[model samples]
Target: MTARPLGVEIACDGPTGHYDCPHNAAIRAQFTSRTARQVRADGRRDGWRARPGGLDICPDCVKETTR
Candidate 1:
């Protein structure tokens, strides 16, 4: 997620109203995990990445950039 002048942006809830995707969303709802590795785990699960320079890249954007 990126930062705006106001609140931070979030990539999880997409157009289909779910993270991962709409396909699996029907089987489960979103949950907040209170874990030590939330950021890294979520990134690995969703293909997100927080760069050393402080840039946050979502899965979809990552694909575009790589291509």
Candidate 2:
């Protein structure tokens, strides 16, 4: 996540009602010991990378944290 003027702009939730996205089988519904980090092109394409100013967060992680 990126540092926002107010605070860190972490992902809040997914578009679907479920935190888990059926469309993306690569991602899991829950995270335990994961720490949100910046994504580089060299890293796994499965995850998202933060934009120059925006943060990247998986749909599942976003939903779980928001709740």
Give per-residue CA lDDT, model 2, range 14-61, as digits (tens).
Answer: 333345333442323232313333222312354533333343445454
Q: Clash number for model 1?
A: 0
Instruction: Write out the backbone clash pairs for model 2.
Output: none
TM-score per prediction, in order, is 0.41, 0.22
Name the best candidate (by lDDT): 1
What number of backbone clashes does candidate 2 have, counting pairs of residues 3 or more apart or in separate chains? 0
**Model 2, runs deviating above 4 Å:** 1-32, 38-44, 57-67
Please provide, for model 1 over 1-67, each residue's C-alpha lDDT reduced to its tens digit, 9 standing for 90 to 100: 9963432233433332223433222111125533424544556576665555444556655564577
Report the number of the highest-TM-score candidate.
1
- Local distance difference test, each candidate: 0.44, 0.37
Tell me how candidate 2 scores on lDDT.
0.37
As a TM-score, model 1 comes out at: 0.41
